[model samples]
Target: MLVYFRLLSESFRFAMNALRNNKLRTLLSLLGVTIGIFSIIAVLAAVDSLDKKITKDLSSLDKNTIYLMKMSFGPSEIPQWKREQFPNVKYDEYLYLKGAMTNTDQMGYQIFTKSESLKYGSNTVTSVNVVPVSHEFIDIQGLEFDEGRFYTESEANSAAPVVVIGNEIAKSLFEDSEPIGKKIRMYGQRFTVIGVLKKQGSGMFGNDDSSAFIPVNFVRQQFGDNNKGLVNVIIFKPEKGVDMDAYKAEISQKLRAFRGVKSGEIDNFFINVFSGFTDFIDGIISQMNVVGWIISGFSLLVGGFGIANIMFVSVKERTNLIGIQKSLGAKNRFILFQFLFEAIILSVIGGIIGLLLVWIIAMILTKALDFEFVLGMGNILLGTGLAAIIGLISGILPAISAAKLDPVEAIRTGM
Candidate 1:
């Protein structure tokens, strides 16, 4: 063990002396390693941030709840025939489905309009998404109220002109004043704010705290005709211990019966288990990570090539030095180990610098935005591993060339 440590220390001292003698060349060689490591670290940090946001967004939905919507959740596009078969589901139908299902815990309907500019006094917030939904939506989406109560079913039934504002919306408009009971105008209609929601922050879809919630029935009455009660989607949770597969089958059977679809006829609706949506999100994030690595890998390749080129130059410059070492009883293995260690050290230093750079960037991002950096230990280990592998592989030819130099001929030559 003492002998190994001495050898390692000697090799390190020799490597440092070599670097000091040719500072410019050493810096240029390390530039490649620096850039390569930087690419990997930056890409990883950004990708990790995006993944965190996506996961947080998906978590808004309960995994046990089933989502019934017009669209499918994945890359498999729904066929035109499927679209043709499934007509718009009406609000009355939602009531019937709710009544028919024995094992459902809760259900909600949602209809959304394109974002609009909202005005309170002189402050106007533009492109704020408005979701007209029933009170059940609050519970389904796991919302918390900051002030006042959500619109009740009776208020929705009566088409009562009440509104609930998100924290951001309230902040933008009323600032410090209580938003509750204040009147705000959206799309030229004045609605009284009944509640202000606690801040939920941003997600993959959009900012959850930048929208307004109103009664689904009231929204339908004002913006929709006979289709006012027609729902865009329905969400429901299953009873405890109920097998989702069996429950799904029963729901399918019931939907077919309710929609009056005959045997062999395709049903006109789409259903999705929450797991499917989460899986789709995971798939997207995985694909993004793969793409990021591929791009960063190209940079690493360039860096590796730089290292190899520099090592080749080093071999030429130190041919006489290698010859002297060989003449002094140094073995070819020792020469190879020395050169390899130098290259590995260069890469590792670059990797550490790159990691620090990425961490600073991530911290800046966290401060400028509401997101948190998610630099898992796995990413750190992976970056370090990649650097070591590149150094070893790129150093091989140079190490071998140095090891194979002819002592007499190399010492006789000026170079």
Candidate 2:
């Protein structure tokens, strides 16, 4: 064990000497490994950050939540023209489903509208996301409040002129002052702020921090119930541990009966499950992983070749040293390990530099974009392990050749 340690120490010194003596050659050799590590780790970090953001954004809502709407969230067998012709989900259907559905825990009606500006006195914030939803939306979405409270059921039903703003919107409009009970103008009407959502940062779909929520009845009243552009959706949260297939079947049966659809005809509305959407996202992430591996694999291959080339040159340079060591009764294993350790040290150093670069860039991006970019321990371990493996594979043949050299022939040739 002590001899092995001495071998490692000597190999490390030799590796440092190579770097000090041949600066440009060593740098050129290390560049491939550095770039290879950077590309792979950067791609992985970005993907992981994206996956985390998606998960965080959807964390409040249940995975079994279902959205019933005229349009499909994912691809559907229903033709686009037919889907377009389908009538929007009605408030009556929302009410009927809420009362009749047995497998549901919470259900609500919501309308996703285009961007609208809000005015507080002379201060105006433009292009803010406007969400008009029923009182039950709060429960269905599991929304957290920073101040005050969501509008009451009576308030939602009566089309009350009250609104709940996000943390960013509140800060933008009110500055240091309290936002609750302050009236803001939207759609050319005054609405009293009732609640403020907690700071949620940037989201996958949109920034929840800069959005406003109001009663769906208010939107219906303002635009009239039959507006063609308005997309009304009914959201349902299924009970935990329930059979999803049976729950979906029950919903389909109930809606089909309510809509008076006859046998053999396709259902007009689409039922989109949240879990299905997440699964689709997972598939996309998996494709990204495959692409990253393929693209970065080339870089790693070039790096491996560069290391192999350097190891061969190192063996040629150290021919006399190996001959002297063997003449002093050093074993074949010692000679082989000396060269292998040098190769590994060089590769690992390059990889460390690459990882450092990634960490710095990740920090800069996280601050610049206000999105968290993480470099987890697992990825770090994987990068280091890959570097070592590359070095070992590249060093083997050169190490073997150096170990086999006849001491007399090697010494004579070097002289």
Candidate 3:
């Protein structure tokens, strides 16, 4: 151990002297390593921030709730067959499911139809999303009204033209006016506003406060196709003590029966529970990990090659010093360790400097992007390990040549 420490110290001293003598070359060699390490750190910081953001967004949904929808999470190039496979869920079927389910505390159906233009006085907003929902929608979504109450069941049944505006809609239409009792026009039809939702910011792709709410029947009357209703999603909160998996199984069977699917046939719809969404998110993160690691590895590979080139040049420059050491009765292992240690120290220092740079960049990114930079012991260890590996591998051939040198022959050749 003592010998190893002595050799390591000597190696660092020799490597520093060589670097000082060839300052420009040393800097050039280190450039590749710097860029590679920087890329890795930047990616880790950005991805970590996005991960936290996604987790926060998803946490707003109750763990016990399940979503019944036509689609799943994560980007897919496959085109959706929204109309053919899963026809829009009907209002009667939603009611039937609610009545039939004994394992749910609350159940709600949502239907959304977007009007391209919504106007208040002279100002207009385009591509405004309109959602029509039952009072239970709030319960299932775990939402509390910020202003007036959610519309009553009687209002929903009577197709009352009362609307609830989201924060953005309220701001756009009413500005400073008291939004309650105010009227807005969509597709030339007028609706009275009864409430306004508080601001909930953007998550993933869509903004939370991007839609206006109205009673289900009102939406059906205004926009429903053939009076059959076109429900987009069904959300349900599980009752206490009910096993979610069992509930899913029972619900699947019931829905299959309702839809008249054969035992051999796959159900056209999907059921998304808390775990399903988490699993989907995990899959996406895993893919990102693959891409990140691949890019980082490639960069390290290039840096490793640069280190090898510099080490080869270093061995040639130090040939006479190696011969002198051999003449003084140094062992081959000693000479080999000297060169290996020098290379390792150089790579390690470069790695540390790169790590520091990336960490600072991460901090800047976190502040600018509103993301958390998750730096820990693992990342530190990884950077150190990578540096050592690059140095050892790059120095191997040069160290071997130096150790095998014949002192007499080296002196006689004098080159």
lDDT of each: 0.78, 0.90, 0.77
Candidate 3 local lDDT, 359-408, one digit each (tens): 88777876887456766667767777878888899889989998999987
What is the lDDT, from 0 to 100, of the residue 144 in candidate 2?
Answer: 86
Report how far off residue 146 is in candidate 3 (Å).
4.7
- Would you list the clashing residue pairs of candidate 2? none
RMSD of each: 2.8, 1.7, 4.1
TM-score for candidate 3: 0.80
Steric collisions counted per model: 1, 0, 0
Give the alpha carbon lDDT tens digit for every residue of 1-415 in model 2: 9999999999899889988999899878888888889889889998999999899888877889999988887788877888888889999999998889996888999998899999998899999999999999888877888998999999999999999999999999999999999999999999999999999888888777899999999999988777988899999898899999899888899999999999999988888999999999999998998899889889888888888898899999889888998999999999999999989998887888889999999999998987899999988998898888888888899999999999988887788
Residue clash pairs of candidate 3 = none
Better of 1 and 3 by TM-score: 1
- State the lDDT at 87 in candidate 3: 61
Ranking by TM-score: 2, 1, 3
Better lDDT candidate (2, 3): 2
Task: Show model 2 residue runs off by greater than 4 Å.
Answer: 77-82
